[model samples]
Target: MVKERNKSFIFYFFVALTFMMTSLFPSSGYAAESNILDLEAKSAILVDAKTGLILYEKDAETALPTASMTKMMSEYLVLEAINNGKISWDQETGISEYVYKISQNRSLSNVPLRSDYQYNVKELYESMAIYSANGSTIALAELIAGSETNFVKMMNEKAAELGLENYKFVNSTGLNNQDLYGNHPDGTGAEEENLMSAKDTAKLAFHLLNDYPEVLDTASIPKSVFRDGTDDRTEMPNWNWMLPTLSFAYEGVDGLKTGTTDLAGYCFTGTAEKNGVRLITVVMKTNNYQERFGNTKKLLDYGFSNYEMQEIVPEGFQVKEQETLPVVKGKDKEVEIESTNAISILMKRGEKELYQPVVTIDEKLLTTEGALTAPVEKGTKVGTLTIEYTGENTLKFLTEKGDDLIKSDVVTTSNIEKSNWFVLFMQAIGGFFADIWTNAADGIKGLF
Candidate 1:
């Protein structure tokens, strides 16, 4: 007996270890087994833009200088202003004397900013986002917020509103203004620069893509000439080499920003769509420009090939699959349940056994005798069914209740006739406490 017990213990221990180790290290074969993944970057993350799901990551929360990535936020704010009708695409804004001088700085990337020649809001925005033109960005900031300093404040405020904790913005252009040669273009000294982790950067990009898809419309244009149809028209090629114009472009690769600074190294926050799936990859501080794009391609390939979105609950679809539960009193003897929302989940390539739901019906849905009571109505929310993702694909969703636990409503599919005795005697008993139970449950739910 003792020898048999020892063997059982050892076998269970190995099973537990396998689960743990496989989960920690993601394997190319199966993601459900967490095999420790590696990436060549200071920090990196791959996420589902729609669900805000982190597909894979490394030091994803470590803040670092973002360089031109700051323009993403600046661009978002400008478009937000346009979306809100505060500004129009054709509205012409004058180039500040400060912006004009900064544009002349050969050290920074810029478009030709002439004080005498005004550019439309749309042209200037494209110049700022596509070329990372500092002058165009500063002009947009000043036009939107009255000063670059105020614009930076708005940037930080927007970051906070988005629940991003790992971000700091001292300038809208993501450049070290004060440390760079001297005072800022707007004369407000810049210092300390800006920083954001891979996770926060992904979130920022997600919002940019979701809230203002027009950003992609601008980003997708591989090359556009500013002040077009005019002599001063300057052609600008998007710095994001992943675009089709660049040989390194990936299929379905489109709009997004890239960043490079002495401190930031080569960084890119890239997005692509294949078949209806879109993914966001933020690779920061890679050794070189090529590596940034190369690693992003690898991440995108892994994501697109290894996972897919599965619709678990189609809205308004009848859910009558689960076995019916017993009902005691009332008109019916059992009930089945269903979900209303079109719930979807991101799952691995071929792992179907990752989630097993443990149906938990509310006690109230059962009778006083602890049996499911009848007189149940179809489509009525009887209780909640909880599906706990387990084993290989154990993703967690932290809530006050539990992590990675999903719940859906359970309802009656059909009615069952109640016993005459139960109907007669139980009605009296139910009348005595039904209101009390209703009040108590409602109060408890209210407290929650």
Candidate 2:
């Protein structure tokens, strides 16, 4: 009886295990993976600037106010102005009444420079970036364009230039209406909405790093003592906590921007590089501070750990060495296409050999003077070298002919016309042989 009971229990155990496996595992027809499988944010994106690949994104098109991050463009415009020689870093800016009002409000980040005091352009940018001070941004705006209105105009024009289709800037400072006094009297959101999307923000950040990298020099400072014209000591600590904690702790955490407001939650644009792989991650509208950092860490860790930047087309790889490609109407039966720079790819571990490069060129359909005249230029639209895996997954890369390809001006050996008189003598000899053969054939037919 005990043996029968044990057998029954074993049968039940097998049935239960099978049920769990079937319920837990994904079925064949169901989706096993998606770009954004798990994320909790209004918007987010992960992009590799070097490769210009969008690894993952969600709600990238939704435009929303980006709060203090608007200062990124303000910083962009300021750098452009400085590059154009409109203003120098040492130039002093008077603390106007508008700055005084914004400073006294305390609702905005301010270092409290006296209205009569004068601070240089350098000091104001420090406060604007480190403390997210509203007053310093206004002063810099006025200094750059003679007034905040003109500066905002320049900001929009730069935005247009940057191809920010879903962005608009109302003020250089990202201070919201709730932080200001009067019915739009403080000029907060007085113009249009200071809005942006995740993709646009990433693009802006990428350009800022590539175009004006000095901003990172300022943004990366964990703590800076700003000595304005006044004696009041306002120490501006970097709002980006990761700057200190991750600068040394995390592998490649570099300088970037952060923003927050009642309406727009904590937003951050962070950049990091490891093993020659650099990427930008943007997280916007997180409910809390921990989630912002946590989500960023999760995304970044996934990027760094899961994906590796692999070179598919290594430098000095002879394009012709891969396979003997056929060429028609040419002295040499094959032409070589080589990679100029090593083509890099981001892929999962153990997948480095998953790609095999293939080259494509135009059809050998045209010829000039018994020589091929293929319309191929340096870096021109040749053919693509695509890497394919076992399945349908594939990535295409461009393979170009080496820059030193011989010109089409080379003389063809099989010329139909000869320049020398010896060419005519040979043609007459060949005609005599042809006539002798024809006469012999005609005499044989008459005899027959």
Model 1: per-residue Cα lDDT at residue 232: 67
Q: How many backbone clashes does candidate 2 have?
A: 0
Tell me the deviation in Å of residue 59 in model 2: 1.6
What CA root-mean-square deviation does each model show from the true structure?
10.2, 8.1
Clash tally, candidates in order:
18, 0
RMSD of 1: 10.2
- Runs in model 1 lying further than 4 Å from the true structure: 1-38, 179-189, 313-335, 358-387, 392-448
Local distance difference test values of all predictions, in order: 0.76, 0.67
Off by over 4 Å in 2: 1-37, 178-193, 228-230, 246-249, 320-335, 353-371, 374-448
lDDT of 2 by residue, 266-306 (tens): 88888877888877888889988777767777667767765
For each candidate, what TM-score against the reference? 0.77, 0.73
